[model samples]
Target: MIPIAKPYLTAEDAQAAYDTILTGWITQGPRVQEFEEKFAAYTGAKYAVAVSNCTTALHLSMIVAGIGEGDEVICPSMSYIATANSIKYVGATPVFAEVNQEYNLDPTDVEKRINSNTKAILLVHQIGMPADIDAIKKICSRYNLKLIEDAACAVGSAYKGQKIGSHSELVCFSFHPRKIISTGDGGMITTSRKDYYDRLRLLRQHGMSINDRVRHNSKKVIFEDHIEVGYNYRMTDIQASVGIKQLEKLDWIVTERRKIANKYHEALKNIEGIRLPLERERYFSNYQSYSIYLEKSFPINRNRFMQELLDNEIATRRGIMNSHRETAYKHLEDKVNLPVSEKLQDRSVLLPLYVPMIEEDVKFIIDTILKLTQLKTV
Candidate 1:
């Protein structure tokens, strides 16, 4: 069966891991620091803190951004629960906003949701396509809201020539296998703010003023005191070793994904009752997942279409896991009308997309989709 996503790893990654094991410094050591520096340089961010996963990164960002009890963080409803979960982790409330037809946060809707209790705007670049960053940034600036970018699927994506990590004050990236790059399971937080960078460094390692690596090299064994409560969210050196190698090939992997996306666009553009993913002229997406919207006129419901694909040995998924519908978040204020987001929740499907997929696989998927369309017409 063709899988929805797969990690691309080479001998370089294996060799790096071997080296880390041989060195016996596998817990948040030199390799982790190296990975953070390289990632920051790649995204043009002043600092990058490697963590256990994107969820922890988002949680750290909330703490550093000063979000706390009763504070509302405005975020899109059509995103992974991690975006809202992080806000809750900080004892803050998540105010869900609507999304546009493109499955991104609607800036206008976000503005209407902002209240005196609002502290931040958490924006996710769903499926690697950038959200309307420029408009979102403008709105955040107007309201003096802290902007945190949940760019888990947008590692190499850009908006208006600036990288996604550079656009927001705090940006989170995932290195999960499903993402453009992988370190098995890891995440990083990029920021231009020096204070945030320093605070995050402390936060990731149990709020200790000094990290273990620093103490290891010192003549005196120094035990540190925790300045504030923090979690053990540091990425292991083994993971960082793989990440460093993956970072070297990030651009190539994104290029391959984009090639597959282009093929899908050309083949599926004319098919009625199908809405192809759109990339604005000013943006360059990593194409983490190639999502297509099934129009209301489509004869088959999204669930049936997904089941058909599964039967054909092809794997597909619904768009970003909707936060509001999830059992954990159902208690939050549900009065907001997120028409576009809700429609996408019911109709959108993510086709198989990854760096290793070739043109042949792309053709097969597109042909299968077209055949389904033809059958519906009959």
Candidate 2:
């Protein structure tokens, strides 16, 4: 069966891992530092901290931003549960907000949620589609709130002419296998501020005054100090090595994905009850996920529609989650009105999208969907 998403790994990626493993400095070391520097350079950020995954990146970002108990972090209800969970990790409450048609936070809704307890606007660039950064930034400025970008699926995406990481004070990216690039299960946080950068670096390494890299490079046996409580969220050198190679091919992968996305867009545009994902003005998405919203006008319900796709040997998945509806977050349920987010949670589906897919595969997926949707009209 055609699967939903897969990594574009190659012999080079495996070789990178092998070579790094052979070096015996397999934990967070030179390769991690090198990967951090290279990623920062690529994304136009002053600093990048390589971590275990984006969830930890978000958690650390919240801690450094001084979000603590009684603090309310305004975030969209429509996102991976990790986004909300990260806030909860820092003892802060996640205030669910409305999302726009693009499945991003509505800036006006964000404005309404702001009060003295509000600490930051944790905006997500959902499914690689760039949110209205300018509008969100203005709101953050007006309310004196910190703006943190959850760029987990937005590595190659851009806002206006600038890349997503470069525009935000704190931006978290995932290197999951499902993302545009994969480092197995890793993440990176980018920031222009040296203070935030240093804190992230220290926190990822057990709040040490001196890190392993510095200790290894030092000519003398220098002891380290535990400055504060910190988590062991460091990314391994083996993963970082793979990430470096993956980063080299990132642009090519994105270009290929976009080519396939365009074909899907053209093939599916005229179908009834199908609402395609949007690339808003001045935004450049890498199309990490090619998701579509099936309106209630459709003859088949979401479950049956997915079953049909599965029977056709095509894999599919539900769209971005409504974290508030989760059993773990029962307290947050029905606490806010997020119409667009709720509608999407029930109706949207994610098609297979990855670097390995070519034009023919995309065409096949599109054609199959067309035939299914056309059956009712017949």
Candidate 3:
């Protein structure tokens, strides 16, 4: 079956990992530092911190931003659970906000959720689509709230000509296999503030006064001190080695994925019962996951549609999740009402999208989807 997504790794990626292993410094070391520097330069950020994964990146972002228990962070519930989970990690309340047609936090609804307890706004660039950062920034400025970005799926996405990671003060990115880039499994946090960069480096490695690399290179004995409570969230040099190669291929990956997505757009635009993902002016999406929404009056429901694709040797996944509906956040069901988000979650389906896709497979997937929708041709 054609899979929904796959990492575009080459023999060179494996070689990078192999080379790092032979260096005898597999943990966060020179490679990690090099990866961080390259990533920061690529995204136009002053500093970048590598972590275990995007979740930990978000956790660190919250800590450095001074979010704590009793504080509330406004965020959209129509996102991966990790988006809200990160807020919970710091004992802060996650105030669910509504999403607009673009499946991003609606600035109007976000403004409504603001209260005295609200400390920050965690904006997500869902599925590689850039959110309205400028609009949200205005809200933050007016209310003295911090803005943190969950750019897990937006590594190659741009907004108003600027990369996602460079726009926000604290932006978290994922290098999961399913994301645009893969570091096996790793994350990054980019920031312009020196204070945040210094503290994040310390906090990611148990808050030790000196990092392992520094101590290892020292000629004299060095005793480290734990300055504060911190978590073991460092990325290994092995992963960083792979990430360096992945970073080099990111632009090409995005270009290839967009080519596939455009094919889908051209073929499926005429289908009356489905809606395609949006790419508004000035917002450049990497099309991380090509999701199409089935209208309420569509011939088949979301589950059946996905099942049909699977039966035809084309794999598909349900749309973005609604964190508010999950058992972990069930109590939020009564507290929040997100009509747009709920409808989006229930009606949308993620189609297969990846780099290095075979032309025939892409055609087959498109033909099968068209047949299932009873269009046969577009």
Candidate 4:
């Protein structure tokens, strides 16, 4: 069956992992540092800290941003649960906000939700589509609020002329298999601030006063101290080895994904009651997931459509979920009224999209979707 998303990995990536493992430095050491430096250079960030996963990256970002108990972080509910969970990890309340047509946080709605308790705006570049950064930054500037970016699916995406991670102060990214790049499962946080960089490095490795690499390379024996309480969130050298290779092929992978997305746009744009994803002017997306919004006038409901695709050997998934509607966040169900977020979650469908997909499979999937979505008329 055609999968919803897949990483563009190669034999070289495997070889990198194998080579790194053979070196006996299998933990967070030189390889992790190299990956961090390369990633920071790629995204134009002054520094980057590798972590176990995006959730840990977000947790660290929240901590460095000074979000804590009684503080409210404004974020879109239409995102992975981890987005909201990170705020809670640092003892901050997540104030769910609405999203615009681009599926990113709506700055206008964000402003309306702001109160004296609001501390920061956690903006997500949903599905690699860059949000209105300038617009959101303006709002943050006006209110003296901090802006942290959830760029899990936006590693290669650009907002205006700069990359997604480079545009924000504290941007977190994922290297999950479902993303354009893969390190089995890992994450990174990019920041320009030296203080944030130093603290993040310390926090990811149990708040040690000196990192492992520093001590290992030193000629004299040195003792370390736990400066503060921190989590074991460091990314392994095994993952970093793979990540370094994956990062090298990221631009090519994004190009291939965009090609597949363009084919989908061309084939499905004529269909009524189907709203395709959009890339606004100067906003470059990696097209991590190609989701189509099904309007009420659509020929079939989202569930049935996905089932049909599954039957046809083409896997599909529901759109980005609303964390507020989940059992874990049931308390927020009655407190928020996000019509757009709810509608998009229920009606949108994610089509199969991956790099290096065969032409025959791509055509077959497109043909099946077109046939299934044929407009009905008198």
Provide the lDDT at 50 for model 3: 99
Ten consecutive residues with minimal summed lDDT in candidate 3? 369-378
lDDT of 2 at 255: 93
lDDT of 1 by residue, 165-245 (tens): 887789999999999999999999999899999999998998898888989999987888899988899999999999999
Worst 10 contiguous positions by lDDT, candidate 2: 369-378
In model 1, the clashing pairs are: none
Regions of model 2 farther than 4 Å from truth? none
Give me the candidate number with maximum lDDT. Answer: 3
Per-residue lDDT over 1-378 for candidate 3, one digit per residue giving the tens place of the 0 to 100 score:
999999999999999999999999999999999999999999999999999999999999999999999999999999999999999999999999999888999999999999999999999999999999999999999999999999999998999998889987899999999999999899999999999999999999999999999999999999999999999999999999999999999999999999999999999999889899999999999999998999966778888898888998899988899999999999879988999999999999999999899999999998987788763321
Displacement of the residue 14 alpha carbon in candidate 3, Å: 0.4
Residue-by-residue lDDT tens digits, candidate 2, 26-130: 999999989999999989888899999999999999988889999999999899999999999989999999998889999888899899999999999999999
What is the Å distance of residue 277 in model 3 from its true position? 0.8
Better of 2 and 3 by TM-score: 3
Per-residue CA lDDT of model 4 for 104-187, tens digit only, reads 998889999989999999999999999998888999899999999999999999988998788878999999899989999999
Any runs in candidate 3 off by more than 4 Å, and if so which?
375-378
